[model samples]
Target: MIRILFFILIVLALGAGFAWLADRPGELSLIWQGQRIEMSLMVAATLLASLISAILIVVWLVRVVWLSPHSISRYFRARKRDRGYQALSTGLIAAGAGDSALARKMTARTHGLLSADQEPLIHLLEAQTALIEGKYDDARKKFELMADDPETRELGLRGLYLEAKRLGANEAARQYAERAADKAPHLPWATLAALDYRSQTGQWDEAIRLLDQSRAAHVIDRKEADRKKAVLLTARAAEKLESDPKGARDDAQAALKLSETLVPAGLIAAKALFREDNLRKAASILEKLWKHEPHPEVARVYVRARSGDSAIDRLKRANKLEALKPNNVVSLATVAESALEARELQLARAKAEAAARIQPSEGIFLLLADIEEADTGDDGRIRHWMNQALKSPRDPAWTADGVTAPEWLPVSPVSGKLDAFEWKMPVAQIAGPVEDGNVDMADEAIRSLPPVAIAHHRDEPVQKPVEKVVETPVKATAPVKVEEIVEQPAVKTIAVPVPTESVIVPETVKTETKPAPAKTEEPVVEPFFGRPPDDPGVRNDSAKPLEKTTFRLF
Candidate 1:
């Protein structure tokens, strides 16, 4: 619109100029190339305008002729570049699809058409394809060729690392991962691979260092870094345990401090302490741990540590523990055994009963048997405890201390109960004579037995009325009264001993009573419930046969 208006205005102005010039008879003159030229003003203006138009036309003709070839060439070059890019794109797709042969052909065509500087992506694609085909050697070559290209360097290193992993070259793989990590620490795959490599090689310290690097680089979250650090620290602790248990203990403790919920660290620390003969510390650790995790092994260790106490006493302590954790079978068993060991027979029995109520199993019966046997040595008492075991559900998890069943043979068939068929004494008789004449020897033998077995064994009486001292779980010394002396200004008196009313002396010196050789009776070993007689007639390898054995009664 502006161009049309300007053209109309120029035409009007020119008409007006011509009318004015024609009306005034105007003329102008100019000198050029030493020649004088004269003309009217309108004629001069027209002549100058005509000269400028001719010069513009000649310049237009020369420019059109001169620039046409270059323009045509540029259009063809652009088309060629576009076609090259198309080939590169197709090759990349094919490479991603694992069509190595097609990708390789397209890659070659792309390379032939595209400039080296423009086709780094194609090289990367070709390298990836080679890696897919398990051609690590070729892949490595391609990646190396493109290593200088900043855009592809990290990717190439990742591909190289993957190729190294495929070839089982862990060291080489680690090297590539490290390089990639240096170049692009935020790359998740590279960081993860590097972390894994460090872990697998037992480079915990290095792994931890790199994890910090990853965190600083914003490659992983803080929580994730802490978790990874924990895992590495645990592995390091395990490694340290073999060479330096104390160091291992520190590491395990550190790990636990970092995450209290970590069970492995606690367990490792406990085991390390136990190995160092720090049973007290181990028990403390276990008790603390039991509050969180009710593990059977932890219970076993805790019970073993409190060997001085009866199963009943242990049961009471365990009961207190149960206040923190209710109906915990492992804790219940620990306490039951402790109570029996402490000679708190009733408490042991109650705890065992509670355990049975919660979960009837061989363990509960075992606890019961421990309490009964601790107070009475009667074969009948032992058998009664065995009966309880037999009646209770068989727990395959229970093994008689060190006794192991045949590997190939199945465990006892008494499901959810003790192995009823295996008994050492008669179960039918609940109470009977607990001891024979040889009480001293029997006491010595009982003392020699393991704490658990002794706690469960029935107490036997000595023929000589031997006075046995029962120890309280906790001991207290009687307070002694001290006589205080004051200065001369105050009168102080010391307490005097009270005089006995009478004194008696025996005519003869008392001596230990000689025990008679009581009749040795064989205990009856019951198959399912009661103990049958030990078969003396049948020859056996070690222990007495079941039929002739006279059962001890408690």
Candidate 2:
């Protein structure tokens, strides 16, 4: 728009100047050696203007003629360059689409049209074609060649890093990533790879520094940076705990400050404080952590902080911890354990049972077994609890990458990921009971066992005996089998031994009675010695009289 306006103004100025020249008429005469020439001033002015315009046009025509060959060459070159770029773009698209044949074809065409040095993208396309064709060695050579070029240096480094990773060359990958990060810290992949390499190699300080650089460069956000810093600091603290407690404590505390819910950091800091004989400080840290999320390690550390205290005193401390997170499994289990140690059987039983009811887990059932054993010396109740424990779901542990650990670790041993361990149940698949043809025999054996009462030590009402009657008719020629079955919900049947020719004991209700033929062998009654009836105790070779005793089921 401005150009058009300027042209219009110039034309208007020329027209006005011509009009002014015409209005003031003047005459001019030119004298030559042999002739005198005279003309009107307006006519001479117009002829001089026409002569200048013709000279300018001729000069422009000569300039164009002189530059024509160069212009033709440039035009062909530009057309070829455009075709090369188009081929390169199509090849890149084909490579992404996994069309190896098309990508290779386009790559060859692009390479034929454009010089390798003229287009940096041609090298990338060639490398991608090689990669698609599984020509890794050729790809590596191209990328290495690109690394020498200033413009493609970062791209080359990234390619090299990925190839190194694919080849499992850890050192080479780390070198490439570090170089890339140093050159361009703003690159997210390079920075993150460099950070991971440092972290995996136990270079905690370097990892933390790299994380800070990434954050400053805006490669990572503030929240992610803070989380990574906490993990690294916690790992460093764990490493220095035994060697330098003071430094470890400082790092752990710093990590905890950054992320309060960090279990490993809290544990490490509390342990460091404990090592320094700062028990109160350690307890304070653990208590603060327990309020957020009750961790078993924190409770253990808290208990350890007061190691010299009596069981009752420890129980009080455990109660204080439990009060912070009342419904937490860790809190309940810890309190139950402390109560058991303090001889507070009722409280222990209540807490353990509550935990089991809330989340039926192996740990809770085991705790209940401990309570039962401490409260009552009855083997029946303890065995019952133990059986429940065998069927209960497993408790949560520090799990990372499908590996579970008894203690928490900041980094995964398998993947070397920060904050990889989680407080959750391990993956488990419960198999159903095997279906075999011998199920009936097993059922029959289970039905033969006598009921053993599960004794409760608490001051609750005793459970009434549950009697189930099963009738079996006897033929004189065929032997009669009387099997006793004990049934419990969600529990497998227990069997009592019965003789093949045993007589059935009648229940209180009236039933048809069948007289049994006299048997030559006396009946034997199996004794309940807390062993399965099928387990033969000892063989007596010497002949002895078979003792007969009346068996009754109530």
Q: What is the C-alpha lDDT of each candidate?
A: 0.63, 0.77
- Candidate 1 residue lDDT tens string, 172-240: 988888888778888977787777766655677888888888888888887777666765676788878
Candidate 2, residue 350: how far the Cα is off, in Å: 0.4
| Candidate 2: stretches off by over 4 Å | 1-53, 428-554
Q: Which candidate has the top score in lDDT? A: 2
The number of clashing residue pairs in model 2 is 7
Q: What lDDT is reached at residue 5 by model 2?
A: 100
TM-score of 1: 0.49
* Candidate 2 local lDDT, 1-554, one digit each (tens): 99999999988987897888899998788989978888888788789889998999999999999999999999999999999889889999999888999998998899888888888988898899899889999999999988889999999999999999999898999999999999899999998888888888889989998899899888998988898899999989989999999999999999988888888898899888888888888888888888887777778778757568999888988999888888776888899999999999889987876666555667777787778777764444566666666766677788999999978776788876667889987866353122332233223322443233334554454543333444453433543343433221112222233455554434332121111223549643433334346433434557464443333232
For the record, the alpha-carbon RMSD of candidate 2 to the native fold, in angstroms, is 12.0
